[model samples]
Target: MNARVEALIEQARGMTSEERVAALDALQELVAPPDQAWGEAWARESEERLDAYLRGDIEGEDFDVVMERMRQEFLVK
Candidate 1:
């Protein structure tokens, strides 16, 4: 294992059980992707958008429309 990871393990070993749990919780929050609220909001939006698309409530552009739009927006030259 890497020295940094070994050092973190050694630090955790010295903590009490409660302290270890707190540390683990803090680590989990830090390691979690994009904070819970933002992720939930994004998921909700995606599900709504997908539902709309599936029901034909929302119209989607074709692949050629997408490619042209992307080229116009992103291509430098």
Candidate 2:
């Protein structure tokens, strides 16, 4: 790594957990900002799903039931 990044990492090591998280978030935004188009697409998708649910064209499962089923399918003993 470059000296500047190494120096930043060393500085980050001295921060509290929360401070480090905030710094990391700031750096991530600088590296790659949030995608507004993706957010708008998801918003539209969510509205469509809700409309379908209201129209009785789709059904929703209980959160706990879905979690239990997912655990059974994916978790290894």
Highest lDDT against the true fold, candidate: 2
lDDT score of residue 28 within candidate 1: 82
CA lDDT for candidate 2: 0.97
After superposition on all C-alphas, the RMSD of every candidate to the true structure, in Å, is 10.9, 3.9
Local lDDT at 32 for model 1: 77
Residues 1-77 of candidate 1 have per-residue lDDT tens digits of: 99998999999999999999998888888887457788899999999999999999999989999999999999998
Give the TM-score of each candidate: 0.49, 0.60
Could you tell me how far off, in angstroms, the CA of residue 75 lies in candidate 1 after the best superposition?
Answer: 1.4
Query: Model 1 TM-score?
Result: 0.49
In candidate 1, which residue ranges exceed 4 Å CA deviation? 1-33
Q: Which stretches of model 2 miss by more than 4 angstroms?
A: 1-31
